[model samples]
Target: MALALPRFAVFQSTVRQKNYLRYIHEDGEQHGFPQFSGEEIVSPYSKFEIERAKSTTAEGNDNGFVHIRCCYNNKYWVANSISSDSFIIAGADEPNEDQSQWSCTLFEPIPVDGEVGSSTTTTTKTTVHVRFRHVKLGHYLRSLVTRDNYHACVSTSYDRRYSR
Candidate 1:
């Protein structure tokens, strides 16, 4: 089942080196692809707004598929093509269900030893980890290590590295 996602959210990488998804303006103007930001704190550049798709596919209707729009630029996320290893970028001025819609799912976050609270013996989880599955490409959204940074892309396999 799909988890109830917030209208606006900050997608963070689930890898060991955790970071939030952000877009850096190219040429200090327009057009920028999604990348993982090194900052640990949430910022306007990292926050995105979720918009419901106008129509749903038979396979994604029950999965709560939706379009992810960047709050910084007001552009929607678009899968490059109907193929594997395509880059997901925030460039679409409008939402197209076939190219912009993504099937979202929730995953249980891996717990780290030092991450647990010490004040209380027991603690309750409040946040939900999410992953975006490309409708046309049939791959999960993942980040690729580019030089010293990571860029957003799609992969065929299921892995925690794809969780945001």
Candidate 2:
């Protein structure tokens, strides 16, 4: 069976926030973990490529197994460790590496008052959120509540406050 692949997209926070996931630019180049930038502007640093993992079977395709690659730096997102609260960084330069793959699940767009879907006919663009679980770390990528820090890998089995 052939699976339909989703187009590349830029991820944004859905908790009534304006933050978008973007790679950090430092020392004259885009190098480092991606962070939530609330600049209200979508740029190349914010774009990401999603591709199907090579190890998946026809059955596994339905599970949404994939790899996320940063468009700015050309690196795959990876979780370094299984320990809770590990920083999910864009470190892997190779695609389909064990640590580079993720299980992606797209969620329905959240409805807000005075926004799209509030009326009978929706015309404005809607925002969709996604949940990506690291294949090797076995943790879900979550946005940090603090505005100063980057997103982290949190164990779904534990409470949010105790993520670290």
Candidate 3:
């Protein structure tokens, strides 16, 4: 279902709010998605197109994330380059790494407009962002849009980056 979709989307963590999965756009150069926080907004590279694992890793044992390639760099995969911080989402001649895979799961669908909350107040849900997890890393994807690093990036798992 996810592989069939194509858009510039980010995965909001099911466990944490205001977190997303993203990569660095260092002046159009390849970079890694290692350290991220709530300092970013959104970038044109944030959007991506998802597809199957694009490999023959076995049939039923394939309980993992899909392959997400940046729409900007159709040749690059959301994987690490040579350096963990410099080259994150780079072009892969043959992609077969764990960092290149992402499992997107929509854990929650926002409530309807007429829905009432625990406080008895009407709720209005607008957007519907998906939840994507890094298969091997076990960290959720997030958009860490920031100004300090023009090549901003997304954190690994939770806001407390080093923690799990």
lDDT by candidate, in order shown: 0.57, 0.54, 0.41
lDDT of 3 by residue, 128-159 (tens): 44444444454454444556553235434254
- Candidate 2 regions exceeding 4 Å error are 1-5, 27-31, 57-61, 97-127, 147-164
Error of 1 at 67 (Å): 0.1
Q: Please tell me which model should have the higher TM-score, number 2 or number 3.
A: 2
Tens digit of per-residue lDDT, candidate 1, span 1-164: 33445688776777735777776665542246677663754677787787655554335234456778888898877755445665677777876654443422211222232243233447654555555676665566677655533333323344555444
Which segments of model 3 are wrong by more than 4 Å?
1-47, 54-64, 79-88, 97-128, 145-147, 150-152, 157-164
Q: Per model, how many backbone clashes are there?
A: 0, 0, 14
Which one wins on lDDT? 1
My TM-score estimates for the predictions, one after another, are 0.67, 0.63, 0.42
Q: What TM-score does model 1 achieve against the real structure?
A: 0.67
Cα lDDT tens digits, model 2, 24-109, are 76653324667776455479878888776665532323444677788888877765444555565677777654434342222112
Top-down lDDT ranking: 1, 2, 3
